[model samples]
Target: MIRINRRILAQGALALALAATGFAAAADTLKDIQARKKLLVAIDLSVPPFGMTDAAMQPQGSDVDVARALAKDMGVEMEIVQVSGPNRIPFLMTNKADIVISSFSVTPERAKVVLFSAPYSVNQLVVGAPKGVAIAKMDDLVGKRIAVVRGNLQDLELTKSAPKGATLVRYEDDATANTALIAGQVDAIATPSTTVQTLASRNPAKNLEIKFVVKVQPLAIGMRKSEVELAKWINGWVEKNAANGELNKIYSKWMGLQLPDMKKLADEARAIAL
Candidate 1:
């Protein structure tokens, strides 16, 4: 027979408590948000067009608008949780934010940790450089210094595709990476096409242009993987907004391009997953 010692009982009780805490942390985020009457959204303010502060230092960008729309539709107030590209997931997982709307590109690896709603936007990754640079292909990246926002999709994709001689310099955020490219700290930059456009418009003398298209990634809202109810609600919201053209208007306002067919893209994404 075995004795029921206090030490063993205490250890087992602690384990159960920890498991319960984990489950509570990940449970029914939609209900929690509704009860609190607020939605905490993670956004990277340094990424222009997607998330940025205007001259008045008030947050204003595509992602910000989207988050605000989501909160408005849900009958809740929005609280922006400013984050960097590398910490978006951490913030969501730690319950620092209810969801992430920060130009988050969906990937298989990321899906393992977070649940993504139907895509609401698309981002085209590209290699950009001054017009004087003769980079027409990935091979041209050889012996070049490339700047990328650390832990972003651009950084991950470029890490896999860049040639052996190419050197990648990681920065903490998109704004810093953009500055590095403009200041000649790096020969090229791996970033979204929107960044290239913003750079050209702001720094006309830099002559920055896209050298080659890297990848077209679908952007979606991200939440903790266990937030099934929240994911379902977000997916429905995206579909409804897409049909009503609200999403398109937001996209065009910041991206200067018509939004792609989100339904078609979502179907393609589902097919790829299967």
Candidate 2:
């Protein structure tokens, strides 16, 4: 009791000091690793089958599982913050998050603004129609209303490939978008395959159907642009877990099925962990 290991004492002291003054808290995620016992992970709370609170009001889904596993491997816990799309990057910029574990799409425009972790998952945009809508293709939406969540990757994707005569009706969140579609405000909802699947399964609408008709997008973790060291560490961490097959288990749990022969994309992503 009288003799204490100096390094252990130092770590304990540092933890106490950081908790008291939050001085060490200003340091980057790596420093947060040495000082804080938990990793602060940001996620989108409105979307499902990715990152969001479940029916029990607890953070859950694919990205949430990955974050938890990564933090555990790093000898830390995870503090999940429910955030929105517009607020994610800004939150990281303000040091409110160690990393964004949200299903953020990696794009050239976005990559310039923040560092992206290796893609852990890929998802495709889909068209969802309730029982009576006969929207067989993008061209079928002439003068039709489509529900889309504002400030999301789907919205960006829709804007890029907007149909000739479709009206893009934006909503604040998925629940709103789905509701609007059900209420005849929108003929269909444009979203990712996973969200459309979750919506149809959880709250079934009459003859609801989800179909994939667009390019798939890669989902990655986000961090500040300058966090090269931590980003490197995260890339390694993700790759290692993926190689070990942990990501597959998590994917199956949340997504409810095996992705159709996309193991090559996952393997290539691991090889390019940078």
Candidate 3:
């Protein structure tokens, strides 16, 4: 008698379902959006400076502003669906969201599954340690215990480059990682620059300082791989907003820093063409 692996079967079923959703979405997502007259965006309402809920419980942040701007450019109403980091890609793959604007960083692995428009913003994953830890570079992580937020790009990056002797403990989120570092549960933490900055701002005496950069992530909007038309339209919108300095204004308003110069959407498009 043959036995089935329930886990494998379940995964297969989910893959089929997601593929069906993708097929239904097809290549003309822009047309569908126009017909429906509403753009569905998946955003994380928990991460601040990028996405969060205001006192009125409405999504308010840089990502939220960008989403609103995109919807306005499309001449459609905006509908936001809150999501966490782990589930954002799944939501897009399953056709539950038309696009993801929740600080979605562009990576080769993710690019294989979904299309990314030009980078909308950029952030760095940095290693932070207590004042006397004496860390200066990636090599210094050897023999140290580092904390990182599970399933985040920083975790992936640190996992890849961390020396074999280093111990990496992953917590559920940035808050947990920061807590562990503060309590001396870990020698250091790998997290976004924003997170570390906020931590330092809140507790000036903690003496947590950035040691080195783990990775520099270029964040972009995400859509189904099949949605070429929608990607093109969104890319165009991003280019226009960026050129008009609207995106810089939004970033400065939320992040308290001026947007840095980087490759624009058109440059990315040109690279793809080449």
Give the lDDT ranking, best first.
Answer: 1, 3, 2
Q: In model 2, which range of ten residues has the least summed lDDT?
A: 1-10
Query: Which tens-of-lDDT digit does each residue in 1-274 have in candidate 2?
Result: 0111222211222133223333323346676675778889988877788877757888778888888888888788888877766567667666778788887777655554567877777777888887577877777876777887665666666666666667677676676887786677777888878877777787675567874476566677887766777888888987776777777788888887654333566444444343
Candidate 1 lDDT over 171-257, as tens digits, reads 877888899999998898899899898898899999989999999888989888788999999999999999999999999999989
Question: What clash pairs does model 3 have?
Answer: none
C-alpha positional error of residue 163 in candidate 3 after TM-score superposition, expressed in Å:
1.1
lDDT of each: 0.83, 0.70, 0.75
Which residue ranges in model 1 land beyond 4 Å of their true spot?
1-24, 271-274
Q: Write the per-residue lDDT of candidate 3 for residues 183-244, one digit (tens) a residue.
A: 88889888777767767776788888889987767788988878888888988887787778
CA lDDT, candidate 1, residue 260: 82
Best by TM-score: 1
Quick one: how many clashes does candidate 1 have? Answer: 0
The number of clashing residue pairs in each candidate reads 0, 0, 0
Worst-scoring 10-residue span by lDDT in model 1? 1-10
